[model samples]
Target: MNPISIVLVRPRDPNNIGACARAMGNFGLSDLRVVDPYEPVWRESVSAVGVNDIMQQAKRCATLDEALQDTAFSMASTAIKNREIKQEIVPLPSLNERLQVAPEGRVALVFGNEKSGLSGEDIERCDVVLNIPTASKQPSINLAQAVILTCYELSRRPGFKAIRHPGQAPEAPTDAQKEIFISSADVLFEKSGFKTDFSSDQRKALLRHMLSRQGLSREQLFFLKKWADKLSSKLP
Candidate 1:
């Protein structure tokens, strides 16, 4: 019953959408947002066994931003391995805890197309990335499968014991702050002559994501700034 919305972006299969709806129903969740869907999500979601009413009430959006306009923050689900990810990877339990006290009133969980998971652009829109562990040989799973796993964890949220994340860690950085931090770091790395053929934005995003997941306190932020300044002095 927490203010969590599941946002599906350009889901290719209507059947998967229906399955996701059913999964949502199982967890007593009804909020659904579909962004740039390839097909009529409501019509396709009619296949949802016991969640027909949810399907009828689902929100369809023309773009991801529109879908998440009311969302306080977003969590992107990624199944690919070893790839550079832009958002911080969080375990299901940690996500559950964070959502319970998330900034703003609501949160959105983003899932990408079945053929391909969320892209860099799609991930950039999210505050964090969640990776569901699976067999190393077969990391990728069906879209519905991923939905069910996440929903299952969500369903058991009330029973989860909350762990007080202490230390001077801040209560997670806002999207804007995260962006600024990463951008600043990128500039410092550039001045340091750190060169990489890899996508620079993605790399910076990953750094931001990691820091955000762990939560950055004022002390940590200041420390990073000092480090950047030190690195800057050594450059040229």
Candidate 2:
């Protein structure tokens, strides 16, 4: 099973939720999380034929943070826009390769509401924004359709195997640890006069992208965090 979590944010319909559960069953992707769902999922499992077990096992979270706090990486799904994107945007085909490089932890693939989609804060909270290719005439896809498509693609990818050899190195940092590193680095950059070259958001985004791509081991991540913490504390 993939270590990815499918997060539905503020879903307002049980039918759609049931369809999503059914889709996960199709791909053998079982980890499902619903944030602020409209109704209890078990109440609507009638539509999710043969997936009652999955629905019953799904985690119901009260907040996005609560849903993703344990995730090592969060990928936000949204429609593509033509404007300059400050965050890293990965294509669906290349996603498999990206996942291979991502550190070991629960990865969350977050979907927005059926109508409005993810909120601004929800999008920002994610590490990457994933956009599926669609015709400009009909850019928006249904929530269940989106889940099925993404899960289908993910199922096609060669899954990640856990490393057991002691020489394999330490595990990757959790999603929360990465956040701490980013925040501490931001403060250090300002004190070191490094923020002058780029805007704050831009720098933080760049730093996040860079560290993520490096695939830092837990010990290596902590080493950077240690210095960032000390340096930030020394600043006026």
Candidate 3:
């Protein structure tokens, strides 16, 4: 399997850290990286009670960039959207699709602080932003739960050929491919008369769910974009 790291940035609660460590261990992920945690409270004895081994192996870094230095790809989990940052904001399942293909790279899944999720600057450093689909009224999710869900999604194989060897890597979609698909899908939805009065949060949730279900490939994205363009030209 590919090496995966679960990164927590400036987490406030030791209990949440402990729970997150357990989740990573349960899902066969061994790497745990902490970036400037509020306190050095994640000792093996206290924080990771049941999963001491995982904690013992966890790495602590002074900064986010330091923790992510060795990673080939990184995804930031954020609840808010920042138009200034150019990184693609994708649904959770898109991460799953990428993992299904390139399961051998050094991939890092980063989560921000409990009170405030990733900032635009923090998110900009990542290759993609993963947003969990949730209701508009209650879109916020617990930190530990978010880590568990993301880990679970990346661990599952979506009909990809199993690679038993260490060096064998699957071919996952690139960031560009994912962005094109999302942009095309958005255009199609607009041309199809979908209402835009919905809050941006709600619209993002709907788009996340729809794109996740479809799992459009690169070729499919191109076709959809072309079709949407043709239809858009003929519309009154």
Candidate 4:
């Protein structure tokens, strides 16, 4: 089974949620997480044919962070053509290759609400941004359609496997570990008077993207964190 979790952020439509669950079932993708969904109707989606088990067992999270905290890498799906952010933008077709590179942990494919896509903060929480190619005339696609397309493409390689380096390497860093390291680095940068054109948040986001691509092992992350901690300790 693919270690992919389908995450819907603040979904507004019960039917869309049902359809997404159905898509997951179609592709043999089991994990489903809904963040801050519209409470009353989402439960109704359990009635979706052939997906009752998935819908019933879906995890409900209060925040995006909670949904992705344990994942090694998170990809936010966005329909917006042009965004100011500098995170890695991946096309949907190439996602399978991308997943192969991510370290051994659950990968979260995050989608946004039906009316509005992911917020900038939500995008920042993810390691990468996924763009589903569509004509410029109609750039955006439906929420359920996006999930279906992603799951379908991923289903092409049913037995998804991650490629990692050889030799007793440390385990992959979880999202929580990455955040802690980023925070430690942020403190170090601030104390050392590091200068950059990007705001602190933007810099952190860029750092996050870089770390995700680097596939830092847990020991490497700890090594970097220790360096940052030691360096920050000397600063006033």
For candidate 3, the clash count comes to: 1
* Candidate 1 residue-wise lDDT at 127: 88
For model 2, residues 95-119, the per-residue Cα lDDT tens digits are: 7878887778888999998998888
In every candidate, how many clashes are there? 0, 0, 1, 0
Runs in model 3 deviating more than 4 A are: 44-49, 81-85, 100-104, 158-236
If the candidates were sorted by their TM-score against the true structure, best first, what order would they fall in? Answer: 4, 2, 1, 3
Model 4 alpha-carbon drift over 4 Å, by segment: 158-236
lDDT of 2: 0.84
TM-score of 1: 0.63
Tens digit of lDDT per residue, candidate 1, span 1-236? 34779999998888889999888887767898888778753455556998888788889899998998887878988875867775577876676776776686787889998998888888888888887888899988788888889988886777543233346535554677666667778878788777787578778867876886776775577677677767777788
TM-score leader: 4
Model 1 ranges off by over 4 Å: 159-236
Best by lDDT: 4
> In candidate 3, residue 235 scores what lDDT?
61
Could you tell me the TM-score of candidate 4? Answer: 0.65
The residue pairs found clashing in candidate 1 are none
Against the reference, the lDDT scores of all candidates come to 0.79, 0.84, 0.75, 0.89
